[model samples]
Target: MRILVVEDNLTLASGIERLLKQSGYAVDCVHDGLSAEAVVSTEAFDVVILDLNLPELDGLSVLRSIRDRKLDSAVLILTAKDAPADRIRGLDLGADDYLTKPFDVGELEARVRALIRRKSGARSPLVSFGALTFDLNARTLTSEQGIVDVPARELSVLELLFSRSGKVVHKHVIIESLSAFDDDLTPNAVEQYVSRLRRKLIPYDVTINTARGIGYYLSKASA
Candidate 1:
């Protein structure tokens, strides 16, 4: 999964980024709220790890702006504020979960998994599409062919496609999902990732079909 970490504390932010990256997530870190807003406005992320205290915009305003714009990505408030009122306010402002500073990485991972699972309409971390099964918590993919370890972004792409199976997903949509606002990726990068994923999925009977001038569709192979 791709995540945006908006925290001003360099050490803490770097630690969070390192942990998330080690766990196979694509992470983008920004120190201030304006940058956070700019990034969210232009780029896509599966989740945003936002700190309540920030320079420029503040986390509440950032959360408000995100909701105002109707972006559906999950938001997790990671801040030093541990008071009950603060937690309630964050939730009321649209955060999906809250984790105070000095938190465990394992707990953070679990919350992230839960949020993604909920967004995908799955009660658990496991999501199934046709004969394929994806375990978001474990970061594993299984099919009749056997098990495969898919990268976080690739898995995210797969999940998005599977959710809209049989329908063409616009290239921009896919790009937004895999990128952060500050990323300098080219438009063709999405196509390249799709091509790479298609090669990996061939054995599982999953086809990613590209419409000439449109986008891509995911569907089962014909019998």
Candidate 2:
């Protein structure tokens, strides 16, 4: 899943980004509300970790903009303000959930997972294609043969592709999603990841097809 963290605190923002990455989620971050608003309207995100206090535009205004656009991404308010009134205002503005500051990493992860599950209408992280099944939480790809261990990088590629099963996903989109602030992942590297994943998934009739000069997308081969 892709997440956008709108936190003004640089140190805290970096920590959240690193934490979510280690948990196998794609993350992008902005340390202000204006950037967050712009990014939210442009990019596709599964969740937005919003902070109430921000520059240019406060988190509440950003949250309202997200709802106004009718964007389906889940919004989780993360702020130092824990007052009952603050929480109610955030919820009333269409925030899917709320998290107070100084929270546990475990609970944060659980809440994020819950939001994802709620959005996907799935009780678990498993997404299926024919005989294949991918567990987003475990980062595992499997079938009736049992567990299928995919290379970590390739798994990241598959994660983006699988989620966009029918749509034509551009190569740049995959690169941006998987890359960290300083991590270097070129289009060629993304192609290599796709190539390897395609080979591994051939047995299951899951094909990653390239749209020459554009990008790659996923499709199930007919028997």
lDDT of each: 0.82, 0.85
Off by over 4 Å in 1: 149-156, 163-167, 181-184
Q: How big is the positional error of residue 26 in model 1, measured in Å on the Cα after superposition?
A: 2.7
Number of the top-ranking candidate, with lDDT as the measure: 2
lDDT of 2 by residue, 1-223 (tens): 6789999899999999999988888788998889988987777788999999999999999999999999999999999999999999999999999999999988998898888767756666888887788776666888999988887778877776665657787888777667654568798898888888878987898888889988988888673
Using all chains and alpha carbons, the TM-scores for the candidates as numbered come to 0.83, 0.78
Model 2 misplaced regions, further than 4 Å: 117-123, 164-176, 179-190, 210-222
lDDT of 2 at 166: 72
RMSD of each: 2.7, 3.2
Top candidate by TM-score: 1
> Which TM-score value belongs to model 1?
0.83
Worst 10 residues of 1 by lDDT: 177-186
